[model samples]
Target: MRFYGQQRLFELTTSELERYREKTRELDYCAERPEKRLLAEECREMVTELEQRKNRMLASAIRRRQREEIEHALDEAEIDAEEIIRELEGESA
Candidate 1:
């Protein structure tokens, strides 16, 4: 379940990435100048940084989902243990 805040963040990140890509393309088109070439390198670095950020966000989401699943499983196991203990007491009584 993606919350509204998360969805908005994802959209913003995508927009920023696209803008960086556009800047890189413009620089590349006129990269005969040394300064333009330098700016293009920086633009490329920003694109790489954005890609890494996306990967990190995906990893975080995966970890969060796995943690929730583990907690749910532990809760079910605890309930089952309690039920078994009650049955054992009834038999001994």
Candidate 2:
């Protein structure tokens, strides 16, 4: 797909871009050594798994940050007594 903007660019999501970079790096590494095909495959699989885990962890971190910001804002606002009490209770518990 064509990514329309100021510069000509290939359309790729963040994950796709990461994977593409990883695949290219792996290809370059594998090309240097011709005899270790099995090891190369295993390493490539490990890299893929690691990248997937990294993405998942990053997403979780972003969500946690957003939740913290929302909680902070709620704490800052002066709401009804019931709401304030609920917030205090939630905090203590």
TM-score per candidate? 0.81, 0.48
lDDT of 1 at 61: 75
**lDDT assessment of candidate 1:** 0.90
Give the per-residue Cα lDDT of candidate 1 at 78: 100
Backbone atom clashes (below 3 Å) for every candidate: 0, 0
Q: Pick the candidate with the highest lDDT.
A: 1
lDDT of 2 by residue, 1-93 (tens): 112541122223345556755765676677667655555665567667656765665676678779988998786675666688999999999
lDDT of 2 at 52: 73
lDDT of 2: 0.61
Off by over 4 Å in 1: 1-3
Among all windows of 10 consecutive residues in model 2, the one with the lowest summed lDDT is 1-10
Question: TM-score: which candidate is best?
Answer: 1
State the C-alpha lDDT per candidate. 0.90, 0.61
- What is the C-alpha RMSD, rounded to one decimal, of candidate 2? 10.9
